[model samples]
Target: MIITHDLTKRYGRTVAVDSVELEVREGDRYGLLGPNGSGKTTLVRMLLGLVFATRGEIEVLGQPVPKRIQDVLPSIGALVEGPGAYPHLSGRVNLTLFDAAGAGGRRKDRRQRVGDALERVGLAGIDRRPVRNYSLGMRQRLGLAGALLRQPKLLILDEPTNGLDPRGIREIRDLLDELNREGTTVFLSSHLLAEIDAFCTRVGVMDRGRLVLQEDLSSLRAPTGRVTVGSPTPERVVALLDGRVEHRDGEVLTVRHDDPGALNAELVAAGVTVTAIATERRTLEQVVLDATTTSSDRVEAAG
Candidate 1:
């Protein structure tokens, strides 16, 4: 569980995280979505107490953060900005050192734990090889193995699939799903909207450091059917629909009506001379763009 109220972080008058209030409930597979440098990472670091907020409050797992961060850390596993390893060291060696470095007094029979982590991330056999020789995806998995070394109860991953190919991404996704099903509350951050749509139970959209929307994925994606109505009588059709239309371009009217047949029938009854009627729907990408896009975002991206 996590909660933040009016949380903000600033660097020399540049606001990285601005008044973000976020909550993650128990058993939530929550995804944090945002463009690059949109404050998602800053917020995550604050949650982990790795970065201090410029203003406002933070709590994690029922304790005030940074203060009780120690009390809650054993329960949390995190992979932020990826993991680093000695280029010359074997994957197994790197993980073993990491285990010793931050075992948090959970240092019992760590050799077996390291083996389990490497096996869990699909790096068991190859782990004895030098990390410099491993593929990008393998290194990413090595980072994941480090996070899993302790069998943490809460997983906080930032762009966990950052450089993986499709197959590797799917592997990571499946692993996260398995972990979540096994009762680890997951807080994931990524630019991969489709992946989030596929695996996340809840989502938070961020733009310019603000949390613009937070909602359950099922309800957020509830089938709101759409239709494209193009008729010679476009004006009359618009009047009939009463501005339920989402888009209008020339002769096409993109309306958000679930029952296309009923709408067509109604239009016919009104003598609207339908030329075209086609179904459409919104994707998570569309929803996120609609929710977070702003003039500033475009300007910032352009800059």
Candidate 2:
């Protein structure tokens, strides 16, 4: 439901986003993974037309951005920077004002929309409490409620779990999961790998103002069992096992082996002294770190 072609944004000589071409299909719990200052917010802002892009095109819900942003934006619910509210206002009052400020939505159903949003985010019980009295996690939920007040077709949450405790984080995760299951397209940006691993169906990793990797979560985590064989004669052991060694540093070797048992047997036959062999798998954390590390190395080398 969202697409960007060669989209770029720059401030002076600093490029916030560089030639980003991205697509998030309908019903996708797509995660934009990146560290802070990696253009996650910039990209989202450009999509929302809050900040104009320096170049390229954007489309949301089949309508071109900027030109048709009004049409597309009304149907999109976003909490880019997080929730903002009148500190003195009660929770209900705050939500009431937020709903009323919406560019679109039936005026008659404002009460119902406000109540539904509050209940959805578990803020209904604190109706009379001032926002200033609410905890940070509570504020996060409140902001989420405002974004979801319109029951948008697409929900864009940038760092949805920010300021949330573990429990609050899980609550938001479940809420997003339910929303996506109900056919809302969820596009979220976060640096937390565990959150993406648990919540996203697909992910795009951003680094140094560029999209470095994008893939299905399942495909990325497929059972490609790896082994770190610590052996005195690591070279002979790898040669005997005919294993595809992907990474090697010092005497430590990481080899891709479908069957560690078979590889172990070959190593034993070759009489290679093995000190350690532990079955391992790549986690989403590793994938993101590797991508960013490689990109940093490349940039440093060129400099």
Please give me the total number of clashing residue pairs in predicted model 2: 0
List, residue by residue over 59-83, the lDDT tens digit for candidate 1. 9989999889988887889999888
The collision pairs in model 1 are none
What tens-digit string does per-residue lDDT give for candidate 2 at 127-240?
Answer: 799999999888888889888877889998888898888988898999999999998999999988899999999999998788888888877776557877788877886676
TM-score per candidate, chains pooled: 0.82, 0.82
Question: Cα lDDT of all candidates, in order?
Answer: 0.88, 0.86
- Candidate 1 wrong stretches, greater than 4 Å: 104-108, 223-256, 260-281, 294-303
- Tell me, by lDDT, which candidate is best: 1
Candidate 2 overall Cα lDDT vs. reference? 0.86
* Candidate 1 similarity to native, TM-score: 0.82
- Candidate 1 lDDT at 203 equals 95
Residue pairs clashing, model 2? none
